[model samples]
Target chain A: MPVNSTHYLFLSLLLFSIGIMGALMRRNAIIILMCIELMLNATNLLLVAFSKIYADADAQLFVFFIMVVAAAEVAVGLAIIVMMYRKVHSVDINILNRLKH
Target chain B: MAIYDILFWVLSAIAVGCALGVILSRNPVNSVMFLIITFFAISGHYVLMNAQFLAIVNVIVYAGAIMVLFLFVIMLMNLNADVEPQKGQLVQLAGVISGGVFFLVILAAIKSAKPELMDKTSTNIGLISDLGKVLFTKYVLPFEISSVLFLSAMIGAVVIGKKEETKPLTHNGEEE
Candidate 1:
């Protein structure tokens, strides 16, 4: 049997779901960020798979843009995290209950 | 079928397993390490998909640059496995339930997907030349927009990371 594209997409979906779960349920802010990266990678996988299926290069360009965006996001995100650590002395996201109100 | 397919499955399994480990591992450092594994596996996937340019980029950006930052933060924060808080049983159960539900839904969606196979086989697909052409010709606008976004984010991060000059506290123990 030939390996199919669906199989890769399926794995991507599974990984994305797990990442979402980690982002939602984890108390640590850094872990949540990692999970978000996982989600992004999952989307990247979907894009590359679809690009191959359709024989289009546009999707790869989108992936390039995504990588750029992801880099920017990490720069800003890590800075914010450092600032949060300075004030709170801890990165327990559960303590961010102040945002819920 | 072929050795390439077999290798794909093996690498994908490792990637997915590492991703799952990222979620389940209690230690943040371990989670970061697992994420590195996931990145490596994704690069492997890119290789299998014939996107050689993207595979190398994936390794360079995600695995190399981003993961280094993650590791640096984890070390700077001095996180310890013992410092992890214990979730209440109910909360743990709820997390597990929701995660399992989401996984099942996604799996079902995948099971329902129609498989599409490539018609013509091309080796050395999406070399640096192909990527440069498509990026400049087809997706130029979005590419430029992403660059502007990065610039704005760079400035914002600089501002956010700046150390605030705190005025001395007032007599009432509040910052003036």
Candidate 2:
């Protein structure tokens, strides 16, 4: 069967839902961050698909910008995670309950 | 056309399966590896969709740069399967159910969208030169701003990752 927008949509949806499940269910902060990256990619694929459907280069540029931002975000986010690890010596989110104190 | 369709199916299966592997793997390093494979599979889909620049950028930026950063951080933390935390079955099930509910809701909403069959013929929009032209023209402002953003992110990461000598953040007064 020829692939249509629906197929892309379903596949992106499934990837996104899996991302959400992984993000919510996983306690590892690093894994959670990875799931967030997965979600970002799910949307990026959909954007590329729609970009193709309309024959616009704008959506592709959006994907480009997203990569830019994601790169910066990863730099900062991983640093934060490393700092958190240095302090607590563990990457578990459960121990982050110090916010309640 | 039929070949593109077949490539799509094969790439989609690889993408989905590897994405599952990303979450299901107990080791952070393995998850990073799976995520890289998932990215490569997505890049393959980009090729099928004729998004050549994006396909290359997705691979170079994501699979190459981002995943490496992830791997570096994983290594810096020295995290292994032994350090991985397992959430309770009830919590995992609840998360899955909630996420599934979200998926079904979106699926139901989009079921009304007319599926448009895309043209897979070669296109100029995805070419490097044409994209560069547009990038340096209309989108140049955002492009410059992203550079600034990157600078700030660099500085911020250094600031945050620096050793703290002021406010203490530990238990039992130990600084190790």
Best-performing candidate as measured by TM-score = 2
Candidate 1: Cα lDDT at B107: 79
Encode model 2's per-residue lDDT on B76-156: one tens digit a residue: 878855567699999999999999999999999999999998866667887889889999999999999999999999999
- Model 1 residue runs over 4 Å out of place are B123-125, B167-173
In candidate 2, which residue ranges exceed 4 Å CA deviation? B165-176
CA lDDT scores, all candidates in order = 0.84, 0.90
DockQ, per model, reads 0.68, 0.85
Residue pairs with backbone atoms closer than 3 Å in model 2 (clashes):
none
On DockQ, the leading prediction is 2
- Extract clashing residue pairs from model 1: none
- Model 1 lDDT tens row, B1-176: 38777977898889889998998898888898899999999888788778999999999999999989988887888885548675667776787788779878777767877888743377444688988977788778887888789889989999998988964677899742
